[model samples]
Target chain A: MTGGTAARGPLDGLVERVRRDPGAIGALFPAVGRTVGRGPGPSGDPDGILGPTVQDEARAALVSALAAALGDGAPDRLAEEVEALYRFGDAEEKRAVLRSLPVLPDGDAASRLTAGLLADALRGNDPRLIAAALGTPAAAALDDHAWRHGVLKCLFSDVPLDAVHGLGDRADAELGRMAAGYAAEREAAGRSVPDDARRLLSLTHGETEA
Target chain B: MRIFDPHVHMTSRTTDDYRRMYDAGVRALVEPAFWLGQPRTNPGSFHDYFDGLIGWERFRASRFGIRHHCAIALNPKEANDPRCAEVLRTLPRYLAKDGVVAVGEVGFDAMTADEEKAFAHQLSLAAEHGLPVLVHTPHRDKAAGTRRTLELVAASGIPPERVLVDHLNETTVDMVDDSGCTLGFSIYPDTKMEPERMVRILQRRGLDRVVVNSAADWGHSDPLATARTGEAMLRSGFTRDDVDRVLWRNPVEFFARSGRLLLQELAPYSGGAFAGNSILRAQHAEPDA
Candidate 1:
């Protein structure tokens, strides 16, 4: 204990990583990082310690997966892995796996995985996961069926602004920007923009009107 | 490691408080002009706040070798007071001066007609002077206020990319990212967003254009919250590169766009704390050198 306490450097991850093989964090996964008054969460597990460690692993795993997927001949083998990742892995594992899809060249496996993750997170009722899912900004990089679904799902999210952008609190700002674009497009296309939304958008053009 | 708190309001604090923060890992900070504890009596207090944000506070922070920068502006809350208009009038002079990175902490508050009026007017003025905006988010019912803030931004048509929305949280992240402007999260003790949560947000969205700030000002806040968040990011599997990117590089790149003075180009303040050195002045024709 004394040695571990005195020990420091980039290897701090390894110490926590050793704790991961036990499936302790994975077992208590969904409850990690939740607050009491916010709402329901994965019941009574105090995941503070495990939460950070698990997230770190998830990120490292994603980074690894992305690097791997970006490599050549990744298709034939990677295809099988993507399919299985969704069916088996839980949220953190699944998310890390999905994040890998971003750098993977658009193809059969990438398409299916992207669509699935986006649809699940954005369309589902889970706000926390959606917030977590968006940590991967691949939505900006995509244009395929999966990307389209993800973007649309953000618009429909229960906590639309809260869950979607998840970065720099620019979601509402982007929602306004996107809504305006849609309105302009509607105008050129000779369609009417939704009345209430347009009114709100008009008022929110830049900064909140008092 | 030594950490620099680039944004704070030490004017609301005492010198002893400064010593405490210094020991607590804050080596520097940026104190932007804000609405005083009570309403500003007049332009003089605003001037004093501006001066302190840039001068006395800078000197005070320097006593600890904690570099300080200032963002001069008429805070939104005080804008409704007709008596406070002169402060906004002084923007032109400060916008071009040193340590003034952006016309900031300037977006919206209250969602009041007067608030919006001041928001739009200041925004326009910032654009006219070609200064970047250090935006402020409303404290109450934030998501709604955040939406309204974005709406005005869209209407203004200032390149959304140049705006830095502050005090972001889970509720407002989606809105900020979608807006395509840079985002700043003030990781304070109780209010604003927390560091652990900020790391999660950072994890979901790779740090391309996001920044984490202490937003530590003259209230109950921390000067090294950014560094703490940085530490959290590291624990969360982000590399040193990622931590530095969110904590320093991204913000440095954004604030550098201010066109006032590149923070990187400024000469390093080399003397010891409280040394007799005055602030950097112009080197004239064959001086004592």
Candidate 2:
């Protein structure tokens, strides 16, 4: 559906339903796991399955299409749809909402309204939520300190840093310092520092290309 | 040293913790449905939480090569909330699901009339479903709460052997022991019960009809407390077989009463990209569906 996978029949069917009645997102969002699929691949990606599995992409695409359909006239409706799906939805549903945040109408207002949701996900131990929270443009709502802590969370939880959006641009000296401290703690505890943390340190030192 | 942590909240834990738990020899666990540290205003949230306990959390544990199981109930603290009472109606549906080893953590939090009412109701649900009950005694008023818990367990007409009275200490353990129900002790990092105290209790109590858990949740607790208690038993001159009896066999025998414990090895999560970030990678461009 996104860029050439098999069977767009179900995805196209969902898109038609949402376009006909945007309100259908509430029901359609949760059913994405069943309609789209978890994708076919080996799960052993070291980056951790804090995913937008290929199927998740299909679901997000459907959400984006709905947002574009609602357009400027119904930002509130879009917001309401996102909120309901996130609040009542499971981890997969929540991830889908987080994935579609950037594509929702009115980016600035959407970002502000969902900042608390982003913060809530960041505060949790679930690597899936943490990665989804930071992986989207919605994460821009997070301030410098919380953003740095999110990176630290990825390090602590072994979520690959590449999952974090805007890491190249946002990887500041403070984040580098935090990573160094975390590395020191891991070393002191006789634990190996994650390669991602070490890579983050190199970026801050301007010794390595992002 | 393969461990079956009878009670834990893996929903609040991380994959790293799962990996560590696996490394420490924990191959299976029963994550009881409990309060989320924040009160829910709607019964729907509990449904989602329960779904995660059975669906996603189960899969997550499988990814770590550990078999995960759960206990379904309206926990004691939340039973007082009339808003949460609606969830009790749905408890039967989940209790009938696979991997639901018991109806649990259901005894008392404040020993309130509301807590007692919900506790008694869930005990009946466990009885109806032929599932075991996991009773959590109040952290405060430990002795009185446990006594009332046993009295209600007796009143429910469910066999005492079908119940697990959790979170007992020196003061409460003897009574739960005498009640003929399985005794559950949660070994914490600092407070409640520590490794040495747990060892002393095992020494005095001898390990029959006993189970030890990390009871680790969103609090300062160890996921490896069961393994630590096993190590403590070894240092105290208990044989490995004795440690195995208490740490592994005892809890297995208790929860397996549900005939639902999945002990077979599952391949760790090897599939890439979960229900997670791949779509967010696209630059704000709405894909044409």
Best by TM-score: 2
Best model per DockQ = 2
lDDT of 1 by residue, A63-156 (tens): 3443353355566445555545544555554544444455556676666666555544443334344544554555553333333234333333
lDDT of 2 at B47: 95
Assess every candidate by TM-score.
0.52, 0.57
RMSD of each: 22.7, 15.5
lDDT of 1 by residue, B1-289 (tens): 3444546777777666666766665554556677654455478877766766666667766654466677778787677566676677787877777878777777665455667888888789778877778889865446677888889888887898888888887767888999998888888775566778887887788788887777665566766677688778878898887776776667667767776543332223443333344333342222422
For candidate 2, give the docking quality class from DockQ.
incorrect
- Report lDDT (Cα) of residue B4, candidate 1: 45
Report lDDT (CA) for all predictions. 0.58, 0.79
